[model samples]
Target chain A: MPPTAALSIRDLKFRYPPGADDAPAESGEGVGGWIVDIPAFDLARGEQALLTAGSGAGKSTLLSLIAGLLDPDPSHGAGTIEVAGTNLLALHGAARDLFRGRSIGMIFQTFNLLHGFSALENVMAALMFSAIPPREHRARALALLERLGIARPNADPDRLSVGQQQRVAVARAVACGPALVLADEPTASLDPENSANAMDLIQSVCRESGAALLCVSHDPSMAERFTRRVGLRELSAAPAAVGG
Target chain B: MAMTDFQIVVRSLTARRFSTVTTIITVAVAVALMLTLLGMKDAARRAFDRGSGNMHLVVSRDASPLVAILNSVFYANPPRAPLSYAQFRQLRDELPVEWAIPTQQGDSFRGLPVTATEPEFFTRLRPDPDREWRFAVGRVFRADFEVVVGAGAARQTGLRVGDQIYVTHGTGTVAALAESAGARVGEGAAIAHIHKEFPFTIVGILEPTGGPHDRVLFVNLHSSWIMHAHDRRLASDPSVKTTGAADVTDADRLITAVLLRLLTRPGQDVTAVEPVVFDQLRRAGGFTVAKPAQEIQRLFAIVGGIHQIFVGMAGVVLLSSGIAIMLALHNSMEQRRRQIAVLRVLGASRGRVFGLMVTESAVIGLLGALAGVGVAVVGQQVVASIMRGQLGLVIEPTVVPAILLGVVAATVALAAVAGLVPGVMAYRTSVLRSLKPLG
Candidate 1:
C-alpha cells in the first residue's frame, strides 16, 4: 500500500453471511482468513487501473464494494463507508444516496440509463443529485456532456449509438465532479472506433477531475491501457467450474 | 421530487382525472340524497312542532282527524250536529273553560247572513291572544240582528258600521225576504226584511289572527232563531196568512252546535251542565276526542321514518362509492409502484407517502360535502315553492345539527376508508422494488 494513493485497501474483508463458515473468497490466503480479503491495492489520483477477470472472478463484486453499494462489515454495515474524507456507506439512507451523488460516480457494465430520460437529462439528473445549488445544475451538466463528446445533448439515450450512450454515461459519471469514478466495462458494447472515442473521453475526464479511475474488463486491449492492471483471480478463490 | 404534499396530491389527482372525478361524483350522490331527505324531514318537523297544540283543535269525530280539525276549528266546513243553545250554556257553566265560544258555520250570505252564535264568538273566541276585540271603525255589535266583521270580511264585502246589512233566511242566499207573511215578522218594514237578509251594521273589523275567524262575520245566536223560526213552526207557518210569532217562538227549542272548553271534569261540576265539551270531557254524543300531539306525533313518525330510511340508503350508496374509489387506487398501484419506489429513493419517507394519499381523499370528501349541502338547500327551495302553490302548507325549512353532522361525517368517513387501501400499499413498498427496473 502506497501512502500517496488516493484510496488504499489493506486486508479489506467481507462475506455474504450465515452460509459462509470460512471466507467464501479466501484462497488459503493471508493472516486471519476471510472472504473478499483485499490483501493490497492502491489507486493513486489521476490514474486508471483496469481489472481483468473471466466470468465469476468477482469483477462486479469488487466494483460494487468500491461503489459502496455493498458493505465491508456486518455490524458497521449501516454506517458510512469513507473514501478520501467522504463516507458513501454511512451517510444514512437518503444522505448515502446524496453522498454517492456528490462524491462517487458509477457506470454499469450493462450501460443502465433510465429509459425515459434523454441523454442530457440522464446526465443532468446526476448533477441534480449532488449538493450543488439547483440553479447551477443544468449549465454544469450540458457542459460536462459536450466535453465528454456526447454530440447530441437532447437525443434520447436509445437514439444515440452505443458509443453515444457510453459517452452519456461518462458525462453522468463526471457531472457531479466526483473524486472517485468507477466504470465497469465502460466501452464493452462499442465498435472499435466508438470504443476508442469512448475510452479517450473517459480517460481525459478522470484526469481532469484528478479522480482515481478503476475500470474492470477482461479485454486485452482495454486492460493494457490502464496505468496498473490487476487480475481478479489474484484476489478471489479459483473460479468454479461449471457442472461441478 | 422537491414538491410539497399538496402540490404532489394535486398533480397526482389531475393525472388521474377520470378516476378522481368519478370518486367525487360518487360521494356527491351519496351525500346529496342524505342531505335532501334530512332537509325535508327537518322542514316537516318544524311545521308539526310549530303548528301542534302547542295549540290544539277540539273536534267531534265527523270523519278523519284531518277533516274534524280542519272543519270545526277553521270554521270552513259545516258542523256535524246541532247541540241546542240551552245545552251549550249548561255545559259552559260546568266545564273549566278558559273561554268557550260557540260557532255556527255553514251558513254564508251572498250579501246577507244569519249567524246562530253567542256574542262571545266575536268577543272571546277570536283566536288572537293579544289585542282583545275592538272595533276598527265603529262600536261592537249590541243587538241580535247586529254583526261584527273580520278585517278581511270587511275589506272584501265593503260593509261599514251603520250600513244596515239586511238579514237573510238560513238558506244561503241573497234574495229579498218574500216569505215575510210566514212565521217570522220584520222589526221595521220591507227594508228590515231582506228575508233573513235583514239590514245590519258592521260594528267591528277584527285584526288578523291567521285563523279561520279572520274571514268570518259574527252575530248573536238569537238572530239565527228569528230567521229560521219558519222551519220550526211549519205546521202553522206553511199558510203565511195565519202565521204569527207565537207559533215560531214556542215551537223552536234547538240551535246549532255548541263550541265548548271544559271548566271542570264531568263528576266535579255543579248545577245543570253544558251539553258539549270540545276538548277533554265527552261531547254531546260521547264522540272520540283526540289530543293533537298524539295525532300529530303519529304523522311525524311516519314522515320521519321515511326520511331516515332515505338517509340510511344514502349511507349504503356512499359505502359502495368508497369501495369504488378504493378499487381505483388499488388498480393503479401496479403502475404506481415504480413511481413510488422512485420517490422513496429520492427521499420520501413512508409516513409522508401515506399522508399524501390520505390527504387527497380528504380533499375529495370536503368538496363532496360542501356540494351536498348546496344541493340540499336548492332542493328545499324547490319543494317549498310547490307547497306554497298547491298545498297551503307553510313549512319552514330547518337545518338540524344532527343532519349536518351526519352528512359531513359520512363524506369524511367514506374518503378515509377509501384512502386506507392505497396507504398500506405505499407503506409496504421497499427500496429494492423501487430501484429495480420494471418488468
Candidate 2:
C-alpha cells in the first residue's frame, strides 16, 4: 500500500563465467560458485544510499546491472531487478534501454562528457531521449546547467576545469528528471577540495529533482554524506565479495 | 540548443576536418571526371550528327567511306584523289539526285578550312533537320573572290564583314605556311607563293549552327579555280598577270567531293533512295561513295570502345572513393567506441546509431556529388574550348539535369552502402566494455 520503491532487488545472483574477461580472480565457492549473491536490497523513492567497497569489489558491476547495460544470465542467476516497480529483467534490450534512459540517471567516475559537445550540448544529449518536447529541450538544459553553477554553457567540456566538468556530468545525469540517479565514483578524479564540492553538488541536485541516489565509491568519507550506507561485503551475503 | 542526428554527424566530421575534407575531395574529383567524359561523348555525337547535315551521300576519292565522310563533310583533311568537274557533272546527270553540290577544300584561311562551293551550299543544306543556315551579319557571297565566314571562324580569326584576307594554298596557319616556304612570317615576298595572288573579301558571317561547319570559310568554286590557275602561271612566268574568274578552264576545275541529295518519291524520306544511288556509284569505278549519317555512326562505334575504357577508369576511381569513405569511417570506429557507448547510454538504440553512421556517409556523398556537378560544369567548358581551338569541332557542352541527378543519387547510395560495415561495428559495440575506464 505504501509508495513503490524506486529500486528493489530480491534473491539476485550473478557471476561471470570462468576465464571471462571481467571474471573475478577469486570466485566464491558458496551458493554454487556465485560471485554476487544478495538476499534483498531496496531504495525507497527519494532515498539516498552510499555503497562502499574495496578496489576490486563489484560496486560498478551492480550499477551496470541496475542500468541494464549488462544482463544477469537467468540460468546462472535468479531474481528480480525492479526500477520504479517495473521489473527490469522482464524488458528486452531496446525496452530496457528506453526505461534506463527515462527512469535512471548515471554519472561515471571520469566525467565522461562527449568531447566535441559544448557544456550545454552534453546536458541536452540526455534530454534528446526523454519524453520532453524538443522545443523545451534547449531551455531545460540551459536552466539545469545555469542552476548547477556552470558559468559558460557554450564552452567545450574538454576546456573546462575538473570541477566544472563534474558539474556538466551532473547536469547531464539529471537532465531527464529520472526517478533514481546512479553515481559511480563520480568524484574519484577530483582533488580533496573539488571532491567534496562535487559530492555536495551531486547530492543537492538529486534531492532538488526529488530522485533517489545510489552512489558507489571506495572513499570512506563519502559515507557521512548519505542517509544510508551499505558495504558490498555485507550486501553480497556470500563468504567472498565479487571483485571486478 | 538540442542537436539533431545530422548536426551530430556534421560536427563529428568537422572534428576530424582533414580526413573528411580529403574524402570529399576524392569523391568530387572522381564524379567530375565521370561527368566530364559523359558530357564530351554526348557533345561529340551531337557535333557529328549536325555536321553530317541532311545530305544523303558524299561522293569523293577518299580511300574508305569513313575517310570520305570525314574529309568531305567534316573537312578533317584534304582529299587525296581529286574528283574532276567532268566526273561530278556526269554523276549529277546519271544518278537519281535532286541536287549535286561540288565542294573544294584544298585551301585554308588562317587555319580555318576554306570550302569552295556554289551558293546553293548555304541555301539548300540544313545543318540539322529543323534548322536552316541563317546569316548572322551579312548576305551570302554573290561573286567570285567574295567569302562568307562561319561564326566560329569569325570569332577565332577576328574577321568581320568587308575584311579582305588572303587564302592560303594549304590547311596551315600563316606562320606554319611561311615556315614551310623557307621564310620568316614577316617576309612577304618569300611567302607569296603559298598564298593566292588575289584576296577574298568576307561579305557575311553565318550564325552558329552548333556543328563543324561553324569553323569554315565559304568561297565560290570559280574563286578557287582562278586562284590555282594564277598560282600555276606565276610559277612558270613570274611576270604573268593574275588570273580572273573568266580564266578558269576545264583543266583548273577540280573539286575534292560532291555532296548529293537523292531524288525521292513524294512524301518519302531521302533514305529510301540513298541505297539505290549508293550502289550505282559504287558499281561505277570513278567515284568513292559514302553514306554520311551511316559513316558518322560507324565512327562513333569505333570510338565507343575508347569511351567505355575511360568510363571504366572513372568508375574505378569512384569505387576507390567509396572505399575511402568506408575506410575513413571504419578506422575512426576504434576511437569512437566510447562515444558510441555514451550515446547508447543516452538512450540511442543500436538501429539509431547504425542509421546515424550511414547517414553520415550519405551526407558526405551528397555534398561531394553537388560539388562534383559544379566541377563538371567548369571542366566541360574547358574541354569544349580546347576541342574548338585544336580540332575546329564546335561542341555544345551541356549538363543534362537528369544525368546530374542520377549521378548524385548513385553516389549517395554508393556511399551509404559503403557505411554499412562501420555501422555494424557501431551497432555491435559493447556498452559496458567501452564505458569501462582505460588502464
Over 4 Å off, model 2: A1-3, A18-33, A238-244, B172-193, B265-269
Whole-model lDDT, model 1: 0.59
**lDDT for position B342 in model 1:** 43
Which parts of model 1 are misplaced by more than 4 Å? Answer: A1-244, B52-54, B62-279, B283-286, B383-391, B401-406, B430-439
- TM-score per prediction, in order, is 0.52, 0.93
- TM-score attained by model 2: 0.93
**Model no. 1, DockQ:** 0.06
- Give per-residue CA lDDT, model 1, range B328-366, as digits (tens): 778877766665654443335567667777777777777
Please provide, for model 1 over A104-128, each residue's C-alpha lDDT reduced to its tens digit, 9 standing for 90 to 100: 7776544666454677766666665
Among all candidates shown, the one with the greatest lDDT? 2
| Residue A183 C-alpha lDDT in model 1 | 77
